[model samples]
Target: MFLLPVLLLLSSCQETIESKDWDTIEMPRVSVHDPSITSVTEDGEEVFYIFGSHLAQAKSKDLVNWEVPFQTEYEDLDNNIILGDIDKNLREAFEWAGKDDADSAGGYSIWAPDVIWNPNYKWKNGDKGAYMYYYSATSTWRRSNIGFAVSKTIEGPYTYQDTVVYSGFTQVDSTDGSDRNTHYKNTHLKKLISTGVIDEFSSNWVLNSGTEYNTDYAPNAIDPTLFYDENEKLWMVYGSWSGGMYILPIDEKTGIPMYPGVDSENQGLIVDRYFGTKLIGGYHQSGEGPYIVYDKETQSYYLFVTYGQLHSSGGYNMRLFKSDNPDGPYVDMKNQVPVFSSTDQNSQYGVKIMGNYQFSNMNKAYKSSGHNSAIITEDGQWMLVYHTRFTGGESHEVRVHPMMMNRNGWPTTLPFEYVNNEYFVSEVGDKDIIGSYEFINHGTTNDPKVLPLSTVELRADKTITGDVSGTWDKEAQSSFISFVIEDVHYEGIIVMQQDETKEQTKKIVFSAIGDNNQTIWGVKK
Candidate 1:
């Protein structure tokens, strides 16, 4: 029966070197939001281990099927849950940061976490191990703690280490170099907690410093990504919608800020002394989810971040900037402009890698595809792993996509979600490109679920047929596909990857986004 071969192919996709069909993929997950992956070997076999928000952790030998070993839910860390509503989380963090009354600022949730191997990290007993740097923040956007837990081995029940940074530092005004007490007296804030007096705190006051949430601190230490450069220098990039994104050098030995002392600017050890640079921000103040990957082949460091609200209906998406230097003056590929510029349209910069998109039929789609992590497999393949909320689905699920470089040296994602399939650089010429294909438009929608794929016919005469009428052509110089639908032009690169519906079938997939900010994904039928 047809079921036998289909089952065989699916098994091969997970267990062997055979090609995988995207349609047959059941993406692995634990509790998915902001999935970050790292590859390591266990017993001479490769494993793609995933970690995400809510302290969810999962691992897979083959990428398609996942098994969760542990998870830390919100209630697990809340002292109030056991004590009938007492704010113990912030108190412990503030105590570590040498402050009192941590109960003032009020948000409670764990966000994106970064797990990495610290080769030179030393424990008190002098044993080194892998570490997971994560955060806990109050919903009011006032208090946060970037803490870490370590494990003797890569796969582990990591023991809590310490709070690396307790947030709420007064912004560093380089102009004055003066200390501003951004942290409010805990006693005062607690008394005024019910009076809506916290509204006076500025969340995006970039120029001036204010108390608690209003501080102009550039490094909003929520989503932490620790990446080491080719030179083996460890760096930490963390931030979200408060001040902006920042990068800081890390002490290889202690796994803390390299220079853990206040600078001449009077900013504290966490804010000024260790703060590296403001990589990007200042748009709608929606910038969050900081992820950085250094591509040695291109001699560039790609800084990826989400630009909108991190919710299914909140227009969540991904954008990236590249820099030759690790701590950088990061710029976009186009015009060599700052990725986060006040003059330019901010969202217009950085390659829009993935967003709310659909492919095939109503069964296949993804939305709010941001808060990602990148990994280079042991076999030297590149992948962008993230979590997405599918159409008609309210839950977040992790998805992986192979990242490819276009003719311009910038990276673009293949149209399909990765399914442990073998993909190759597309070499089809103009003559071979004209054919019948399935086109999926990531139509703007608040409904979280998949939409049906439509049919499109690419004609040799540069005209389109079938479902929706459009003109298709390729750029003469770059050979990138450019097509017009509804008078909008989109440019894209093609790659040969597995078609979602057919097992062992390879097809040309085109992924592009229109000027109207709509993304289109097409798979050759």
Candidate 2:
């Protein structure tokens, strides 16, 4: 009888050791377009915040569970916690760049606001606060101006400060003599001339005198993203389609541009003295929403930008480039430099990190996954935050994906939406990786069409067969994996994550980037 009891106890212990108690985690969803993410400490707890276009804002303690604190509709302006009264408070910006109903029938076209805590910024009362860099645009694509606002807290009733950069100004304005040129001269050029950043006779001093408003050369002056370099120097990268993107060093004390003097020698296409340095995308090529983050481990500055339009049918997708210096000769995985003139296509430029794609398990295919912001968490975890639209409609939702650098020091996102601790793979064995999977090869295309998932099987003999042929292997005692598919070498990281599309079933997944810069993702069936 005692022997029987011992055997029962051993069997129960073995059962307990083999089975896992998976947690049921439900994530709260929010719709915030052009989401710019930042973190702060609130009530002694860490909270992640995302502020986006049209005054939309949301907060979360754990990234999965979000609470939207502000709405995006124009009718809800009064309820906005960031800019309390949009019309009254932002009247100056409206007068400068807001579109009239005759123009677009929309209220103010506020867009792409980025917030950062600036300890160096001293308010009127000598208190420091977070700075909100925002833009206002008229119906005209290039007609916009970038400005800043200040608030005592991250979630703020921010007060407008000043409008810094202006675009789309012409030689003449309205018949009332309030022309764009006059406005530019009085509001911006006078300061630039006074500071010796530009000469009074310089063509750039007058918007119409040169191609300043020309979409082919000059920037659209929107979508501002601020970041600090390794030396803690503050810099701002802003611009959109029409011209390419540009970067300007910021004055940390005043929270404005520290003009890099003038670049009179070479007016070709690259550097601009008054507007700053042009990093990539020019001559009206399709590229916008430039975001840069420095990885300490790789010691490189990664620049991410989206190509195509923002609409659901538009071929909006995220691309990646990197450089040793912040102001860069940024190159893609294929080592191709960004196109400066309209002669070359932008789809052939940057590493197309992700485009529209869908797995077999997904109900709807995701489309236009662009305008992203990435952050390295306090605990050194990298995450990509972006807005993605679906196939059925233009409606969008925010998504967070955990990121990992491959053996080549290139960053690739995991195959699923982040779920707190459920996605962490401590030690994945060969049994976990060898199985049939739904695969997606995110090819180097900047299109709105979704890449449909196909089937692939990983056999015990280290061979892959099905939709594509390949040979796979994993590093001993590590989650890193390698595959040679049809002569292309691919490196990736594998993890066991709960499949959100399937009834939260735990499954193994892999996200890998190929030698040609194309990305491939797999979810085990």
Candidate 3:
């Protein structure tokens, strides 16, 4: 009985990682947040550009070395990307959409810029092939707009196209109006009415009111991400906090939702709340920063999300979920589905892949390692581009690390950032598994301080003794190891990571999660 589930978990954890692909490259030290990376080949040399919050862009020939160049090939792109620059009629437009900024400033911040090559729409304007879509908003939780911009080149002076969709803009005319066209009276809204969510749509029904930004009919429109599905259909997954996440079909030609102006209550119904698939949310827990990457090789769409507070509080961490389809009911390692009302299960659903961590040769421990993006390089290197703040540091710095899938199709990140060191993947046996290790428990809490590494020991006699307490065992044919730590069963695989500070020394590492949804990471000491 236990063997079948163990086999399923172990098989999903294995991934084909080439040792040669682990190039010893060091990414530049820079402060940026919500990074999105794209690669382009110009004149036989491949280059990558990283875009982030506050309209920041950094260019790199190799993923490691970077330069913040404003002037590219075609244009000298402007630095300060203000909201007024993108759209002049900000107040009129947002009032028409029925959403207000978190602050009275009417939305000024640009965040999580996603740039991609739109082949279908490239020739229409006689320009280059890239389109950039970004979020502009105030500190307001639910008030935001996903705007469109186009550039002939990757490094762009991106021309603001138009506002795609406003999150809280359901009733078009909230003020005392004569006759106004609202999204509630639209066809999509009619469909949602048929689903029994909204019985009879009134202008008052569309109006949102709440202190927590949860009274809105739609999902919070921040953190926009764009990607094409297996059928070549362009789709977007967006939302943060309040109403959880949502998915909308994108019209390739217009660079917006297929049903653009329709404001049905069904707008936010696709993910984890009223009517949506509910990617990941908890009872008032922070569940934001949604990015989905479809790995063609695995035939699975991997959903990467950040949870907890995304501040220096050290609660922020990156987690993962995978599904066979793009619009999913995504499942995590334990096959637990994300629930909206329950704060317990969703907190433990996805594997906590990255968090406040410390390695051998670090000046300080890394905290709040979330809000990330992933890409497969032209040379087939899988990388996670993210921002992390060190202990006692005030600003967030960008970092890139290799992301490899396990035999069970789950992804795990390396302990250290990408540096000039080689990692090893050796066959594991009982001898390799028995050792003293430094372990840290990524507990599901909002604590600001990262847990200190605790020492644990694994005995060769199938008995376990550690900082906590447990019995250890391993499968005969695979590297799948499990142990009971304080009555909570934990399972994971043994892999090797190199310590560059010690003559590039290699150490066995284990990353596992308990049945209670807590994650345990260990490195051989």
Cα lDDT over the full model 3: 0.60
Q: Give the TM-score of candidate 3.
A: 0.76
Superposition error at 166 for model 2 (Å): 1.4
For all predicted structures, in order, the TM-scores are 0.72, 0.88, 0.76
The window of 10 residues in a row where model 3 has the poorest summed lDDT is 1-10
Cα misplacement distance, residue 363 of candidate 2 (Å) = 1.0
Against the true structure, candidate 2 reaches a TM-score of 0.88
Give the range of the ten consecutive residues with the poorest summed lDDT in model 1. 1-10
- The sequence of per-residue lDDT tens digits that candidate 3 reaches over residues 424-443 is 55657788888888888887
The TM-score, computed over Cα atoms with residue i paired to residue i, of candidate 1 is: 0.72
Worst 10 residues of 2 by lDDT: 1-10
> What are the per-residue Cα lDDT tens digits for candidate 1 across 308-417?
66556656777767777777767664534333444544566565666566654336467777788888777666788887765565566777787665544556677766
Q: Which is the winner by lDDT between candidate 1 and candidate 2?
A: 2
How much is the lDDT of residue 302 in candidate 1?
83
lDDT of 2 by residue, 30-131 (tens): 887888999987788778988877666777889988776533333345434566555666656656664342233434567778888877887777776566
